[model samples]
Target: MIGNMEIFLIILAALILFGPDRLPKIARELGRAIREFRNSLEEDLAG
Candidate 1:
């Protein structure tokens, strides 16, 4: 399991890599992709 410090460091790395402007857009896209993937998985299980 990841701890708080690890998560902080990952966020810091992301900030440094992507800069401030594009991070939120990238994060939102990632979230949507994850949600879609999870929904597909549930559909497959139900069917």
Candidate 2:
């Protein structure tokens, strides 16, 4: 499992790489992708 410091470093790297303006947009897309992936997994398990 990742520690808080590790997570913070990852976020810091992402901010530097993607910049502040695009980070939120990227996060939103990532969230949507995760949600869709979870939904598909649930449907598959239910079916």
Candidate 3:
């Protein structure tokens, strides 16, 4: 719960800093990066 609150705060800060126009593009790129990182980590663990 506390961690979620912190994440929410950070997201709010990012939105303020980046503005509405850039935030969606930033989020999409961030999501893709996270997905790629998780996939690579899983592959490493399997190997």
Model 2 accuracy (lDDT, Cα): 0.99
Worst 10 residues of 3 by lDDT: 1-10
Q: How many clashes in each structure? A: 0, 0, 0
Question: What are the Cα lDDT values of the candidates?
Answer: 0.97, 0.99, 0.95
> Tens-digit lDDT track for model 1 on 1-47?
99999999998999999998999999999999999999999999999
Per-residue CA lDDT of model 2 for 1-47, tens digit only, reads 99999999999999999999999999999999999999999999999
Mark the regions of model 2 whose C-alpha exceeds 4 Å error after superposition: none
- State which candidate, 1 or 2, has the greater TM-score: 2
TM-score per candidate: 0.91, 0.93, 0.78
Off by over 4 Å in 3: 1-4
- Residue lDDT tens for model 3, 1-47: 57988999998999899998999999999999999999999999999
Task: Give the runs in model 1 whose Cα sits over 4 Å from its true position.
Answer: none
